[model samples]
Target chain A: ETSAKVIDGKAVAKQIKDEIKIEVLKMKDAIGVVPGLAVILVGDRKDSATYVRNKKKACEAVGITSYEICLPEDSTEEDVLKHIADYNENPKVHGILIQLPLPRHMDEARILNAVSIDKDVDGFHPLNIGLLAKRDREPFFVSCTPKGCIELLHRYGITIKGKRAVIIGRSNIVGLPVSLLLQREDATITIVHSRTENPEEIVRQADIIVSAAGKANMVRGSWIKPGAVIIDVGINPIDDPESPRGYRLVGDVCYDEACKVASAITPVPGGVGPMTIAMLLSNTLDSAKRALKFE
Target chain B: ETSAKVIDGKAVAKQIKDEIKIEVLKMKDAIGVVPGLAVILVGDRKDSATYVRNKKKACEAVGITSYEICLPEDSTEEDVLKHIADYNENPKVHGILIQLPLPRHMDEARILNAVSIDKDVDGFHPLNIGLLAKRDREPFFVSCTPKGCIELLHRYGITIKGKRAVIIGRSNIVGLPVSLLLQREDATITIVHSRTENPEEIVRQADIIVSAAGKANMVRGSWIKPGAVIIDVGINPIDDPESPRGYRLVGDVCYDEACKVASAITPVPGGVGPMTIAMLLSNTLDSAKRALKFE
Candidate 1:
């Protein structure tokens, strides 16, 4: 039997979505405005397409309006810009999200910067990230994954203040922003990256560990401090002949080993993955509320 | 006997200024352009006035044209904004700096935001900070103090990559940005602020320590790891009966104590203080170079 408490992100994400559903209805009733999220997808990447489809369904489930703009692979940067400009001006579009890994020819930074800071639900805007890094200032939206990680910690009543937090990885998307968030909560933060020497020693000192290295089983049971909280953001796939798909998803932390050592942990597949979409919905709703001056 | 080498900031700053002076002359000879820096001082605070005067002197020594705008204490935010707008359009002004601690009535954030990001040599712009925070993206200018801190580390040949660095304090101007800069150099960084439970224990683990907490003698010898490098950014005044001024400046790290423990250490008065202005000049020269497209 696993002695550690499983941090059920799937159930918590569902609870959050249900809460958002009720708020979405109340917001619609009070202001007669439905929260709207616009997704801009370029090219025919099947994975991106699936993500877009899932987001659209989630929007529908919460009674929020969803807008999708799918452009061809050969579409010029100007074509994408034109749509972003329109969405930026559209009052109904409370949030604007551009699917990642746009066409090879496209300038990703330029295209991402084109979205208005107010509608940057992905929290990719430099201004938003900068504000989040600064003390006493808040971002309009924190990137969904990082926000979800903090939400999980909050839900579990895990105290972050004065805690030693170690973040594995330094990706702009998750690692950097999450470190800033944890620091803002008064947790002394240390970020261990690829170049970090003795990574296991650094990871072992953490009261709270967030592993986003994207390396399956990179964080071993020996790397965790006994009774430390682990939020694994990695979802790496490894060959598993026993499975029908011949593959299995595993977190950066070895689940079996970590469960024996850590006091609390988030499982892969059902953990941070589901919370991302929920946070997107929450950001859209909040943006709509701000637009209509709703409390 | 103290064995630690003193990291001489006064001498290093002078060397940098002399180097900048030659570059300024070279640029003028080659491009018929002189670098210009504009200082906007609001109110009549003696300390601010002294700082502006010193800056003007420093600019003159380096052949950089200095423009000063001294506004009355009762000046409106519009007055400052109008000057900043004029300077933004002024091709001669390569850099713009506003004296800190604006009047109580003025919105500091709004005024700081009004400065064009290109000429924001103070590097207080959120966009600049955000770019600095992101991986592989460089800010137009890093805040002077943090930039100076890194420069000192580099000049002293202290290895940052893969090292354990602990920063005391989290001020946006110094500690936060310094941590980001160190992280960018691939060092694992831990920031210990007021809320840190066992700061000394954490600090003792660092190979490099940067203390900017502004608390005189707060970090005792026991807090430092033997042979670690120390960069003290604190310039706090403590009363001294022996001094004619009745007070003397001390750093966050007790120099007498830390000098014995650290392999290398920066002295309070002669260290980070001189480097700030030197970095300001450096940024101004770089901005002018970028503007003129000079290599």
Candidate 2:
């Protein structure tokens, strides 16, 4: 079996982040200005806190100021709105990210919509979504997860125009927009979801595959084309007593098997996961640059 | 060779237009008000003029008040904006449509964006496009052409859930949004284009096929599933000495070849074409209803 070349999402993402850092330093030195990101942490979930902390560290590493707001899990809906309102009005904050899975009591939709589109660096704003779909043009801010997936393909010199591409998982955050993005680039795209039957056959036929099915090993070597580039977005936890957490994170693709058939594939831990944070920073830098008319 | 079912686009469109007329009368009598559409016709292309005239007559047939603005071929950008501004503030106008294919010197994108979203009956507004993509939850008004194709399928009770559906073509105006609307209703969709190396093989696998390739006889009946539902959105003009215009209209799929193989199908001129205009009116009514908070 021929072992496939692993697409180094980690290294590529690091390179991008490093480039952003240099540009940010130049902006501060030349114009006495630095990009700022405001993160609204709505609850005490360990995952959300970790993301907030990492984002702040990323901001500091890049010379961009980071504002972190850690809210109680019991905070009311209005309590969250107040923070969004403040960020919207603040000139210093160029980007705003509200950690997801807000408490069930609060309306996630309404609060997310409250962030000014200009500061919606996270790109969950409806206005950005609209702009992205209109005329198949590049949206000011695209949802980070989808953007990251597409960037990996683009940097690898993969062509989208008129290519047969199949995407699994149809969630708004990943599948739908990515499909639209690919279409904008004029790729022939097919979207299969939970409702899809014989998804294996569909995947096997595509020249490229983007798997976000969250089910460990749902895609295997048999499902891939010999020269296909595969991007696995699923991070599923399965039982593995050998690991300290009593479980291990694996992507939707069975990496060991996929590596033999796929021309190139992304790894589980170091793949798309790291790119998400990097894209968030990129979007913030983009917002800053657009606002300052630097680009 | 098995003959294909002839899907009648004209009859379907006529029925839809009649339905709109009835609905318009009901709306008018109920609130002592009628739906209104403002159309800006730029330049004097014969085809565009005919489309505008048809739309005006359709509006009158349905109790909708039609407002026409015929600008000269050399109208400046400011001139177009002025018309948009007039429609934007007009309380009587519920929808605005600026006919496409403006003169070479005009910027269509800028003009399209000028219409207020509430009055953007054509559903080309960036805000509306984003709303359609976000979570596929609350779409403002889906793009007219795609929305029309879906409405015909829905009204006819063609089940798409868990079905193997393949869509040929990916234009923003038709293929992309139609596929999204289908997915929202739980259909598994695959988009195939000319670039697809094995379109025939892919189409054979689909239980439902939507052909908008804009090519004559691109989808052969032999490629269709035994009982697939076919929706043809292609409107290709082929040269024929038999016709007075020295041309004849045909769909992307071969009609004679498709009808026998497919359980159901849509015809070229009478099928999905009429629904395009009907949905435009429907969207206009939707625009007014949402604006007036009529539930």
Candidate 3:
């Protein structure tokens, strides 16, 4: 058995946030422009509110001008689109992001598509997606979850090229695009989806594992190669009476089993989740500076 | 040793063109509109010219109207963009194609990006590429070579879903996009590129092999599985003193060896080559009819 290494995502996130803050300060001095971010939060879901608060805190910490648009739970798709159009044309709002899992009445795709590509900090624009798919081409805004996974590998000095990368799931948001990104970097990729009969055996052979299957404990310790790096993207809620929320956050991987086999692995709550909003803030600042012709 | 089934791409191509001709006649009689294609040949390269001429004659034989434009070898990028804009705006023109490998001074990306996504029958536009990458979204144009190979499989009544398919290459034009298309049909895909250490072993394990690496006869007969369907997309020219052209075409798979082992394999010149221009014609017709709102 290989000795396990813990991937310190909290420390890594702090380093990234500090770097963005420094750039943000330079942007303010040179271009007379501080990057501005607009976050649209719908309803009063406690977790969504927490995420929104974290984003606002990150923006403030980075010296970014932050605006929060809180809407009532009964908002319509038209309302969301109008706000998107408003942020789209507003001079001050260079980057716009709507907290995902919007109210049921809202058409998520329609609203997301409405955000102009130039200001789409989330990198969900069709143009950016195509750019990501292009061989040897990297988009300005790569989707944050995948970006964070790659960054976790990079920060830990794990080489992805020529490595066996096993991605669990094939959702456009995570599995598919991450595979594209990894392929561009010259990694040998194997995608295991629902139809796969031997996912554990497939995963156990990975030099690098990216789990976004959203299934709790799907990737067990037994499914990992000794000394593999694990980037878990799933944020599942499990019943835990000891927690005040009446549930606890769990990832797709069983952390205890993985910690014994993986060389480095991220914890569910502190790993990719925090990095997502941080990247949004980073991309927002990028869009702001770029929109102002500063970057 | 398994005997490889001959694919007979030449006969297949002839039959397809004949069928398209009959369909064209019926459409002409039923409706006053005839499919129109615009080909822009910017260089004096003999091979490019021959390809342009072949496309034109194919359209003529099928009773589709062909519009030809031959500019000098040193046409300005602006001049090319202007032509593309004109064709894009024209109501009567249904399809427009610019021959690739433009003059050294010209920007290929700029010119390719100029074609409207709606009229981009080649499916080379960023929007179309983006749409193609999405799991559920469909692009208007599928790239020619990949489309042709898939059509061959479809016509042969080959089921792709759940098959173990391996594509050896990762080019944007062929390998990468074709993998996406095949994945949509539910085939388990494994992409092996130049960095792959054991490509031969990998190919030997696949039920379906799409060889587009452009390395002549790279996939040896021993590497193919019995009853595997192979579509060879490479067209490499080797010196041949016996031929007047001084060169002969060869596919990525050694025909002598592949024919001995593979259940089915496409031939070099007559294989994927002819299907490309045919699909372009189909895309052009689609562009024209959609522009005219005929369907």
Kindly list the per-residue Cα lDDT of model 1 for residues A220-281, writing each as its tens digit.
99999999999999999999999999999999999999999999999998888899999999
Candidate whose TM-score is highest: 1
Tens digits of lDDT, candidate 2, B1-295: 5554555667767777787777777777778777889999999899999999989987887778899999999999899999899989998899999998888898777888898977887777777777776664576678888887877777777888888888887666787677767877778787776667678988998888988889899888789888898999999999999999999999999987888899888887787888888888888887777776664
Off by over 4 Å in 2: A159-162, B1-5
Return the number of clashes found in candidate 2: 16
Full ranking by TM-score: 1, 2, 3
Candidate 2, residues A1-295, lDDT tens digits: the string is 7887887889989998999999998888878889999998876889888888988898888788999888999999899999989988887889999998899898888998899988898777777777777664557798888889889988888877867789898777887778877877777777888888888888887778888888998998898888888889999999999999999999999999898888888899888888888899999988988888874
- Candidate order by DockQ, decreasing, is 1, 2, 3
What clash pairs does model 3 have? B4-B259, B94-B288
- Assess each prediction's global lDDT (C-alpha) against the native: 0.95, 0.84, 0.83
Off by over 4 Å in 3: A42-47, A71-77, A103-107, A241-244
In terms of lDDT, the best-performing candidate is 1
Per-model TM against the reference:
0.98, 0.95, 0.94
Sequence-dependent TM-score of model 3: 0.94
